[model samples]
Target: MAEAAAKQRSPATPRPVRCIVKLGGAAITNKGELESIDERSLRSACAQLRQAMSGSGDAAPGKVMGMDWSRRPGDPADPAVDTDGFRGMAGLGIDTNFIVVHGAGSFGHFQASRSGVHKGGLHTPLVKAGFVATRISVTSLNQEVVRALAREGIPSIGLSPFACGWSTQQRKLVSANASQIIQSLHAGFVPVLHGDGVLDELLACTILSGDVIIRHLAQLLSPKYVVFLTDVQGVYDRPPTDSNAVLLREIEVDDNGGWSVVKPVLQGNKRGVETSVAAHDTTGGMETKILEAAAIARLGVDVYITKVGTDHSLRALKGDVDTSTDDWLGTVIRSAK
Candidate 1:
């Protein structure tokens, strides 16, 4: 009788499906390390995120910023903490449960590749150098993001991407104790995950890029939504550059569906990045993001790809939208029956 009473008296817990928002590197920061970071664009994204989190049924968004943290021996953190991180999202009646996962935009991506120190990927001898570069770069970004969140009364932490315990054997996460994520969610905490060189069972190498991380997370956390802020508004029928390119508002992920490979709309520092045109060099690009998102969407999660500048990001979270942009916001590749 006592046990039954306790069970009945227990408050019904709200099982909120997790939320995954993957901000592309090009969207958040400038391309090359030699180039400058875009403070204005970053601020815009932060503001919208803040607004969305304060939205109805949204509560405070668990925030995470993942990056490749690295630094030269005596480098100080980026002095100008702009309006990008979650802390910048505050004051809009939104408190981000912040999690940050950033990439190694300048640090390892260039150095390792150039040095050829890391012959291939994770197992490369230059891995130590790569990890060093990744750590410094990622760590710096983490601190700034954390500091911003902390100032806003939102607790934040810098967790390593590799430490998340995800395997790339089948190109998906096979093991991870969801308890940590569960606890964080219950407490309204945001866990951030970014791409890093991880041990891959199939390729016998290391895979880097936040794209992989987002997919693994979707499968594990079963988030309610996966928002990828692609460089463009959404997918286009033809190459966006092709004067006749039409923006595809929505897509159904059938075995054979509608999605064409157009020239990449996103551009890095034009004067830099030898691999700038190397489409497959990076993690999942627009196509991969679409396919991955579609697969997860099949699991009943709504996925959206929108320009970081538009209101679609906020509207999508609200669960209703009428996209009116021509640049393309995003396309939902619905799963095949």
Candidate 2:
């Protein structure tokens, strides 16, 4: 009977995606304010994304603002470049099949933290109320994001992890209906997922972070590249607020998943960078993002971390920016082996 049941189940393979873009909640929303979105930032990010995916015919040529727009030799032969039917990037004509995952930011964090939702134990009324409140806030933000994308003619569908049978055990995601996301991608619709409160076996309930979700999806989809849109320029040797902090351009991960900065080694204080998480944030913040990026890098996918609504970010999303060039103001994580 078990063999018959196994044979009855059909296998679903996800299509090859060109890129996965993670919109940091801090980048799109005002973290200092409760449930407030940075409208200007969100609109700009959506516009830039639209431009990157659909291409801009009027963009300046031959290295605009120190970015290398110069077409590489035999560009048409690149497997990543596809111009058959889909709208391609300007000058490059590259097709981007991408997904967007966003953080909860101020929307759900306040509720989750206040009620100790991350701590679990759904037996309490406060925890249950917090779960509902968190979902309502995050899903509202998701709707706003999807609407913004729609305004730019991008077909986007929001998938709530909590509503979609994503469950965790001991705060670790054990199962998710990834096929729904894959099917959405195969149908040419952008699947937008977010950090959410999910049912847990051991804890009863816990926060499933967007960073963790990105890492999970990357492992399953194996996209060519992943881009993290942050509020800052990129990963720095120390906290970016510090005057002596320096941006680390490239990080290489070994076969065993260990990583080291490969460009512009730090001159002093190599004791590792210190990151500060928001008081109300249930998630680990920037530190978690870096850890997830490293995990994705270990899977042989290049990851780019850059500020949203910037020229470099737009280029990175379009898959045209060369990471080796010093002009690109971002951190890229890649596999060493």
Candidate 3:
């Protein structure tokens, strides 16, 4: 009986994740671009992400995507959340990984604004100035991200899209260092990426978003889940009000209302660079995220959009939920059968 009990108590194998999690800036802190990051909340969120990627126990093993990182030298301030969380998670023996991709927080917002980038839309008098400014911010942010990761025992490194990624005339990424990133994951090292400075293409410069890196990761790794943690609780039925607003349980790709149901506010600082995210399929907002997640579902991926709340992040990563609806704790985006 003792031997039988021992056999039953043997440690179970871990579950492999075909998942990619996109942690938004808002998810890290209340301060969009104006305020500095909240280390406590940020660290906790990362710790949960680590838990999900961790092996066995209350947590489940996974291949966590970018944990709030900037791969460039000039990127904005280092986010204490992801960097610190990675350390705590490392203590638990999880294989933590990240694809560092971040935006220009305080760094470029002013320069980009003054140069008149966002006002003129894509390219204008402020365009060149905006691009240059954007680069600086990205580098600064990346610097901080790298520092935080190093403080942890994850042994991660930075990667640049400007150096490695190429785009087609059709606005699609022609090539990227997907293989190298995968190699890092295989070796137990996290490969960080960020909203790149400027990638000179055939015609002009291409502004990269974390979404770009996200799509690439989804295509290459084909993780089992994709969790998007943001400041909002989840996609809402009309932007949330302290008074009354509904938390959507699930959202199907083919659902009638779609992105029309939720409004993505451009509540960033006055000095931020703006991207035009169309109602249709495009990168940079919820619409884009939902569409992309749906596309990845063909490859069998589960996508979750939730807030960066205290314990919720861990539950999402561990696939611990009690709802059959699309969005459980948050809005769930799924592909139609």
Candidate 4:
């Protein structure tokens, strides 16, 4: 009987994810303010997420219109959707096996930067204090995000990277328990993770950026695709603030993770595009985001970067946007031949 009980208690295998959506910190929070959330943008994002995840049978009022699930020619074959779990529900528009990751904008960045938490040296009183303060702030934001998703009738549970034993060595992630995330997916809950202060083998403690988290998750989960919802339309040839800055519609990434703009015929190194990081953002900002997106693309998973709360974001998340047309107003990073 004990053996039988043990067998019954065996962990279920994790389901393959349809996609992973990353909510940029700056898009959902007032980066200039201390711990201020952009309620309007957050609400809009949650609503669109509901629409994208809802099925045709759902009575939800703002169901997404004109979503085509069929893959386009030259596009990678869609990942197999699991048919025996929560995703197996009939009439579902898109597979329910997905993950949401968010950054720490005004929530924790100010405290972290002030305390120099990302610089390590936790043996110092300042670093230790900053670590604790940073966690408190970021986790507070996580709760708000979970509450917002819950309000939209989405089953979301906050998962902190620090709580999951995610640690780094010399600013590079070396250990993380992907099992926690997988188990959450297996149990039919959308795991909502956020950037947080984590232990570092060398530095003692450091800040793990959400962009890096997304890259690590993509490597472990191998989702069909990844979406980054940001404040801008997409990656640009120059700073978006510049009048002459042009949005690069599509970026082709080679196996080695090098990328180049395939649209509008841009010259010079796209990676060198000028971008401004927030004064309080300890993370590398746009440069890190693009680099991580390219890394994900190198793994054969397409990455979409678009403005949050836009139709393009919704379509990109649903994997039904027509990328060949000029109507697509986002940048798609895909593996080149």
Candidate 5:
């Protein structure tokens, strides 16, 4: 009788499908501009995410339904945090839990380059100042992201790595707590994290990439999906800028966690494509992204690398693979395991 009573009294836990979505720097900000954010792109991405999460398809015709950015926590305009429109799986009914991580783009990259944060730890006063500036830049961007999500009626709170994360002296993320994220998710709020300068065990201070953070979070949180929103269509046979480059629709990691590339039709004269870091991007660019995706895929997580500012992001989130058709979308990186 006692055991039966204990079982009956226990509250049922909500088993929501968890997902991690990254807003790439290049997609959301003009890398050429210092600390400049593309408001239109940001807003559109947020709205699409809102639509996907709500599963309502109830966006206002020709306009998205969201709160004004100026609304505060207690304001009437602010919707209840837990009262989202997401109806979940129609047949089995499961809520969706989203965690957002964003890149620094122009904000941190310019400052990182100026400070040489990736070279090693901070030593000189000048380099230390640059580190501080980089943190400030990324933090400011975080605020804008949170505000945008709020306007889209997504309950989100900014979580800064500078405050809660630490890295090895070599700048590898060694330790951190997911309690905040866990608590926020439990309360139906999205926890937003960004790439930022972190204290290094060996160097003093160094830069941490959002991609790295995603890998760490995936291992800890075990999200079902990891979606990367970038400026390009997807992984390409070569850099899409090349005259002969073509989009690679999918990538599969072998049981040994190795990548198997699915080549697309060539656009021009066939040539080897190199994934090099961009001029201003301090973080390793396409190369790092693919490597990170591969690393996470090894852990049994589905990874999507899609272009932002398009319907590709939504398609990836929905697990829709239309690449064989004319309506082909982003690259889906899957694990052999």
Candidate 6:
């Protein structure tokens, strides 16, 4: 009788609702400052993340999309409210399984530049020291992120690529086991992954960009949605700061298996260089992000490139507005119908 009662109390195995959220460096950190995190932005992003995971069917009014949370502090509607007293969408009868991957931003980039870690292959002792420092820096940022999520009553564990990944001499992901990640989700905790300095067969050690990590995890997890929250609204026809630039609302490979016009922007210029990438950033910035998004979209996952620190894109991702309709604000990438 006791055993039967325990069985009755056991939580049902959650249905996998595979979703991946990536917070870009520029949106979460002050890239020009060495190792500085934008706490307000981090908090805002985490808030939206929690809301997204809550399985809430309704979107807050679009007017509140980018509303400044810091200024409002204890607003009851604040997504950062602790779950103890605040009921979430899960309690409203929905379940969600999510994974989060965040970029290194100022944490590792400047140190990696000074250390020459991106150059690949073994270098002088100074360069070797940079690899160690880069690891330490990114790990530090990961700890802070987990702590912030905890403040909001979100359970998460940080997974470092350096600890659980291997790359070939060509930097291909040779072997990576994400069994622990799957276990975490089943246990009802969000698994967080980040870009870090990882050992390389020929390079000794190198920076693995978070964007690359997202694509790798998406391929392994086959999430239904891949949401990329960046500093900008979405991919622009030209540089966003340009007077004539307009956001590309959607991008998809054509029926002929051809690329979108946005492909050239994702690939950057003839030199394969992007001006928006921080001077010290060794990882490809917006360019690589778009390229990875396109690749993952072709794999049948809906990919979204949208602004961080806002609810508009997050809501769009959850089907608040039919992406099939023009009401969706962010760019959606999918295989051409």
Query: Backbone clashes per model, in order?
Result: 35, 0, 31, 0, 3, 1
Q: When superposed on Cα atoms, how far off is each prediction in RMSD?
A: 10.7, 10.4, 12.5, 11.1, 8.1, 9.6
lDDT of 4 by residue, 1-337 (tens): 2232233332665577888999999889988889999998898888777777764333545423222233435868873333344354455344458799999878988889889999999989998999999999999999888878766657788999999888899888877767788888887778999999999999999999888888888877778989998888888766777777788777778866567777655654454332232111122377778788988898889999888888888888777666678888988888876
Q: After superposition, how far is residue 64 of candidate 5 from its true place, in Å?
A: 6.8
> Each candidate's TM vs. the true structure?
0.66, 0.82, 0.67, 0.82, 0.80, 0.77
lDDT of 1 by residue, 7-71 (tens): 33215343565467776666666675532345555556555655566565545554443222335
Ranking by lDDT: 4, 2, 5, 6, 3, 1
lDDT winner: 4
TM-score, ranked from best to worst: 4, 2, 5, 6, 3, 1
- Estimate the TM-score for candidate 4: 0.82
> What is the per-residue lDDT of model 6 for residues 1-337, given as tens digits with 9 covering 90 to 100?
2232233321543345468888788878887788888998889887776676666556542211221223234566645433443443334222337888888888988889987897775567977888888889999898777766655546778888777663545466555556667677877777888888887777777788888878777766678888888777777766777676666666665434344643324434322222343211123366667678877887788788888777666674464535556656677777765
With a 3 Å backbone cut-off (N, CA, C), the pairs that clash in candidate 5 are 168-201, 169-201, 169-202
Model 2 compared with the native: what TM-score? 0.82
lDDT of 1 at 208: 56
Q: How close is candidate 6 to the true structure, as a TM-score?
A: 0.77
Every candidate's lDDT: 0.52, 0.77, 0.54, 0.78, 0.72, 0.68
Error of 2 at 218 (Å): 0.5
Count of clashing pairs, candidate 5:
3
Model 6, 201: alpha-carbon shift in Å?
0.9
Model 1 stretches with alpha carbons more than 4 Å out? 1-14, 34-36, 56-107, 115-124, 147-154, 170-172, 201-205, 255-284, 323-329, 335-337
The residue-level lDDT of candidate 1 at 258 comes to 32
